[model samples]
Target: MGLESNSMPKIVIGDFGYTLEDVPHLSDFIPDLPTYPNPLQDNPAYSAVRQYFVDYDDTIAQNIVVHKDTPRGIHFRRAGPRQRVYFESDDVHACIVTCGGLCPGLNTVIREIVCSLNYMYGVKSVLGIHGGYKGFYSKNTISLTPKSVNDIHKRGGTILGTSRGGYETKKIVDSIQDRGINQVYIIGGDGTQKGAAVIFEEIKKRGLKVAVVGIPKTIDNDIPVIDKSFGFDTAVEEAERAINAAHVEATSFENGIGLVKLMGRYSGFIAMYATIASRDVDCCLIPESPFYLEGRGGLFEYIEKRLKEFGHMVIVIAEGAGQEMLSESLNQKDASGNKLLQDVGLWISQKIKDHFSKERKMTINLKYIDPTYMIRAIPSSASDNVYCTLLAQSAVHGAMAGYTGFTVGPVNGRYAYIPFHRINERQNKVVITDRMWARLLSSTSQPSFLSTKDVVEDSMDDKKETPNYALLENGFADAHK
Candidate 1:
């Protein structure tokens, strides 16, 4: 409870095309030796990754109460001397890996590193850590090459695959020590970041030379000060695609409600942004605003009002919108002091259906979840591409310059690499929503949803924008037409 500081670290950020004289190169996950390598469908590592870190069948529901008390906070390990040094010697090799959930632009990040290390800088011993940290210890190797990363800029999912359970054991920690891996780039979400910190702590504890650089890789945009995660734009673009498409369907059907959910548990940025970008979303629910029954009435009543006003409405629900009503997540234990993730998307949909059924006294048939996976991986959005590349470049630069305990984030729409010198420092952390983005979503019409100001009065500061209607001069103009 005594971690406090107020200065951002000035780490060196290696450039994509520019190289420094004193900078050290990172490792490539691909092994120098390649054999008839194939994958096992039931690789033991796969089980651990899905079960321990990234499983979809984990029976989640929209519960709001669980989101309070302990918010979704990521704990970073204080870096000593391991994750700071660069792998300059042949004895040391560096590789990038993704663990747990699939990020939108894993390929962008990995591609940037591969390009920078091999083409820009002199370091070319980079390897691809297949299946995440487990691959670091696995007997297999995925060496980097011009052929290996060819056309990866537009690909989705990790070519190396990912796992979540690799960091929970001593053997995994020792495997890095044995293999002489100097550093590992971990590109993943909260769970993977946690694993990165744990691995860093263990690697340093074992006196290993490997560095672990954790690039914020969630489409959820929940990570700090980076403003938005690498894949968030890609996911939002995909969501916008789906939402806009659904609007077409809603129009063609003449009288139907289309609901699509996005992947933001503790933040509504995705839901809000996607809605803003598209021309179909009628309402959006995010974690920052909890649902109320009595004072704010029910979501159904609001929907009914929208129906009365617009005949049909499209709703964009953030997955984490219902954290206030649910119990704490099992992962965030009783003593851990972390709140649970709420799934209000599903709840809001259900509540609408229930309300419609009662009000009309008829079975309400509606479409809600259009969860398209790997939207983060599609590599279509320019913002995501730029963001991923900046992160990779900054990561390499930060390492060569000796920066630790920090995550590279996007600041002012550019990669402003931030180091966590203080555990409880809020300045280094990215604010979820700024006035600029809020002003973008203030319109009552168009794709983005509008809510009663009183319902989210407490969060108004975070919601207000500088008001730039020029970009959306014709907000929801299509809807009226």
Candidate 2:
């Protein structure tokens, strides 16, 4: 929501029975900031729309589920083109930077951001910051236009390039101020968003008129406060190919086992979803559920029994799954300070082979397939392409409206402006007790592989970590109006 009828800005509540956490605005620091009519009103491209401007009090609910006793829940400022913007089209200068690992739809987001700025707002001076945050000082800036990014959506990876952990807020903010970039679009995961938040703080400390907008990007679908990240759909779609290949290999030989490793550093959505989608998978392992190798209710016993009955089976494991069973030396950290995970695929594969050959005195054929980089290096699926477009446009809209220190994403099917701290506070992990995980268990017929104590502990932990939008009454009408 953008325009204010009165000169005074609306009050933003930090937290009450309901949460109205709004993003920072230029008006928050600078008094009597000039407002310009949104260029979209005069653009022929938007002339066909009947109603375009978002209401000042419009918001998107974070949680749609409610009970009779539910208190007012969390809501976020809705994202869209506003009638009045804080920045004029002629004065606006924008730059975009991508960080962290490669993912599908990265290029699509870049292409759309450039295109939307030029076509919709008639703001043509868009710069692409090469590499990650270090790109501000170390790398060259390339001018981006609709013409330059026309066919980039068909490609994989980010055109701006990316790296891990080069966040120097002072240096980055200095670069922005020196270059006259009023709008900063950051595309990356939680770590990158954290850096974006710091950059916003530094920008504000200097009393500069800049808007920093983050578009959450992760193939893992692990970012919180959003329904799902952009490339997740494409990652799930591509995983089906690997699962099919594994099934083919496993079914070809007697006593065969197909081991497929998927990318999920902390979450298991990819492995879980792929197992459910492929139906041929006999077992799925993820970081959320612990599994043992020996004794009753162990993975070895289940695998042995399954092979004896069916002659062949497929096992899908997330990269982060079974980390507790790995060597302690593998528990290192990367440049981004994320724990370096050991290869669970190879370890489990060898263990299965050893158990069958040495313990059971039998020979078994096993094949392992790692499609981690393969999935990340491919272009996004059709659905993800459309999603990237929407996310890019939303970031542009928020920046133009002078909303700073915010990230744009679809929460409960509606796009909203969420503050950065909410996302980086914690990861969006897969709840083992959720019905979706139960569906995966049903599909694969895999044992929960969890002890009574583990289950109880997890349940208690979930209860302790209540969601931001919890127990809300029907205050949507009263809250907004």
Best by TM-score: 2
The TM-score, computed over Cα atoms with residue i paired to residue i, of candidate 2 is 0.91
Please report, in order, the local distance difference test score of every candidate based on alpha carbons: 0.55, 0.84
Give each model a TM-score: 0.67, 0.91
Query: On residues 143-247, what C-alpha lDDT tens digit does candidate 2 reach at each position?
Result: 999999999989898888899984677888889999999999999998888788778777888899999999999999988889999999889888989989988
Local error of candidate 1 at residue 115 (angstroms): 2.2
Scored by lDDT, model 2 comes in at 0.84
Off by over 4 Å in 1: 1-92, 253-255, 293-297, 323-347, 362-365, 374-377, 402-405, 413-417, 420-441, 445-481
Query: For residues 1-481, what per-residue lDDT tens digits would candidate 1 score against the true structure?
Result: 1112222333232333222111111232222322211121233543454332211111111111243354422221221112223434333366777776677678878888877655533466777878776675566578886567977978788788876553434666676667766667778766555556566555555555456677876666665544566677778778887787666665555346788878775556677778777756766666654444323334566666676676677777777665555544435622112344545556666766776677556444467665656464566468778767777876765554344345565544444334433112221221224452355446433322223344455245565544222222212111100
Model 2 CA deviation exceeding 4 Å by range: 1-17, 452-481
